[model samples]
Target chain A: MAEVDEASKPLLRDLKAVGKKFGHVMYPKKSTTLLRDWDLWGPLLLCVTLALMLQGGSADSKEDGGPQFAEVFVIIWFGSVIITLNSKLLGGTISFFQSLCVLGYCILPLTVAMIVCRLVLLGGTGTASFIVRFIVVVASFGWSTFASTAFLADSQPPNRKALVVYPVFLFYFVISWMIVTFSPSHSDGTTDTGP
Target chain B: MSTTERNKNPNSTESWGGFEDNPIQGGGSAVIDMENMDDTSGSSFEDMGDMHQRIKEEEEVSEEAAATEEGDDGEFLGMKGVKGQLGRQVADEVWQAGKRQASKAFNLYGNIDILRPYFDVEPIQVRNRLLESLIPVRIINFPQKIAGELYGPLMLVFTLVAILLHGMKTSGTVIREGTLMGTAIGTCFGYWLGISSFIYFLAYLCNAQITMLQILSLLGYGLFGHCVVLFVTYTVHFHSLFYILWLVVGGLSTLRMVAALISRTVGHTPRLILCATLSALHMLFLLYLHFAYHKIVEGILDTLEGPNVPPFQRIARDIPEVSVALVNTTVKTISATLQSY
Candidate 1:
């Protein structure tokens, strides 16, 4: 027992020394600290931004306004969020604003395609002859999602990565609101509103 | 090393008779006469003959070894000078084995040496090429981002299950309606959410090679087809076969998309996500749209007919029927056209 105790004393001292080294590395001296440390402030800023987004209200309010317009908005917003997350996940090589720009640019072709679908499927022009427009809406929406994911997002500029991101998401939200507010309301022509 | 040297007379002891004639050779007296010593019992004329036989056996064994060594050396040298070196080397080793067998036959004085030449035929080149081609077509440097083959069939099965559940829910089977409906909703949402998340990950995090425009365009085409079918059938009272035909078109288009995805530089994870999302969103949107539209038309129908109106006085009755029929027909047609699964 005495011999074993003698062997363990050096080991105990070595462990204590290692612990002190670790503590010293972890603790900062005045000279080692920086004024503009992102580690200290970055997350705080992100949280504040996120709070702002949440405060913009539920993303589902376009249901009564226009499902098609709402859908396009959702697609764009979702894509922007993805871009933002992606940038953050990649150590902020991409920014929220850049993702927004990418999102906006991406939605352009999809919107055009959707408009074409609308013209093709619902081109009839009389009040009594309102064409069935769902096909164009759904097709455009689905295509927009696919095109944005596959093409525009892939082609986003690497340098201005995050700068274009947040704006794109906001654009999606705004466009969706516009689509809801402006789409031809079926309510105008119909008297029955209940189940 | 030759067999002939081994067969040379062992009786050449005449040159070494001085050593042979030593008293040790006769051994008449027990020199080391330890009590109960048994040398006389262990030695005899039979033992002498046995010793001769053992020596002969050892010489035969050594001769065989020497022959094999020579055989191997010849095989190696023969292989060195040959074209198609690898094939020749293999053939030479086999030839060495054959030569060994032939040598053994010569040693044994046997007649089994006649058939060795027939085994020397080279393999046919066409046969070899065919054998090579039989190897599986391996996709080299396959991206490990996702196990594509596994995920594809899995997604397909999930979609089928969802479709089955949706069918059951709409089939008016009451007792299991709740379960079917739950499963239908769950499957649709699960597939959509999962695919959407993966797409998000691929676009943002993985920096996928695909563009959003391409994806959206494909989906838009499908939706446009869907809407057209709905409108045509609902408004024009087209037969259900037109819808079926449209569905066939949708299927073919989807297959084309899949082929395109595979041929392009699209990664497996993104492609898989694309497929899953397209399927889920298409199903969810179509189902909801159809049911909701039906309910809207029903409300319109109820309001068009006042409570005390006689059958003859229903001016808008036919219009409601025509409108509902048009919507239903168009829905079915477009839904069929959009069918990828």
Candidate 2:
């Protein structure tokens, strides 16, 4: 009985860690959660899921076009890596992963939008579905940009806040494009912002 | 963290939250020990030092728990990453040298010791895993990694590619071989891995917990449907056939992919979401197949139309002659029936 109790402790600890991270994501009012004891697990997961959802024409050969998970995976990771480099080069105060954590975790709203879009698409995907999807994606795009910049704004050097925010905007915009154009060939969860 | 999961059965996918942990936590077996965790690993930064200390600590805890004798020996053999990294190279070499002998003495299966981790209650069924993966009928049963096979999907993919290449060659399509191979392999494998990873991501989203390989096996089998579409183009060659085939293959695979995922889904909305997504995947795959290879039907017709002979004339030449008496008797019977009417 004692051994069984001891065996299960690690599992309980892991649950607590995930719950705490989720709390921080749900309420982006603090940076200490992601800033101080940074771990890539949350970011990596959100990145993979978002990449999978946004899988578009990037992976296809020239003729039979569509994005591959590899392309989305590379784009998201490399995109963030480049942004991290830019921030650090400009003498940002935060570590690379902390800034990355901010960018990655803020994608939660967009990810949820993807899920909702997928569900809305279940009814039909004509002009109406496109409109619904556009609103949701626009809202998510706004939310992601705002949240990431909110967290990362302090990390930038005083004069170069635009420089940091600009790249962050581009990064999220690229992700949003992937989300908007996603057709769910596996039935994408997000809606088409345009026809 | 993943080491335990690597040993863990698919049954444990329900609570996948703890997966993707700090990879530092190997030798997960010795984690059962409660005491001496601090004294051994307190100074060391490496996870191996923690495991080595935990294994030593297990000896004291063994008096009460008494089940981890094999767990200690299996660590050296399993966590190969730790091979040369430990502080004492000479002692590590000695430990390496004794691994096989140690495994034989302590593990349940002796030399076949890797099996100890999986500890199956039911027998390993390779045939079931293979057949089910192709059609995805028995989804309630979690796919056992030990029993999973890639040969079926791999072969079907190869055959479909080969058939498409052959069709293009015979039809005088002038695409370069390199480009053809690149496109075929890319679409085949890209779509396979892409869609599987997508479903995996979806399952993760809905908390439907599944192993990566299980999802791979489930989606890999859809290649069989692609092969079916290609095979029918030969004898019954027609450009319009794909429309009907899409309905048949897409609907069936949708049902199968959904049923397979059913056992793992968390609830109603997820079920509906998965059903829509899976059916949509099937629809896309069928359409992709048609785009890539529907020309094969026309190609087959082109081959059959050899040198001024339409297919009807060529086939007509193959018919054996009919007797005049038989023709006359059939005409007389038809005339009598018309008179009676």
Best candidate, lDDT? 2
lDDT of 1 by residue, A104-160 (tens): 433443344334433542554233332233333334444434433433333444543
User: What is the Cα-based lDDT of residue B201 in candidate 1?
Assistant: 54
Residue-wise lDDT of candidate 2 within B190-215, one digit each (tens)?
A: 77778878888888888876777667
- Error in Å for residue B199 of model 1: 18
Q: Comparing to the true complex, what docking class would candidate 2 get?
A: incorrect
Best by TM-score: 2
Writing each residue's lDDT as its tens digit, candidate 2 over A1-195 gives: 999989999978766775687567666774676677766777777778776765533334232223456655765676687677656655577876787777777777778888877787677655567677778888888888887777787876666566566667766765665566555432222222222
How does each model score on TM-score? Answer: 0.24, 0.35
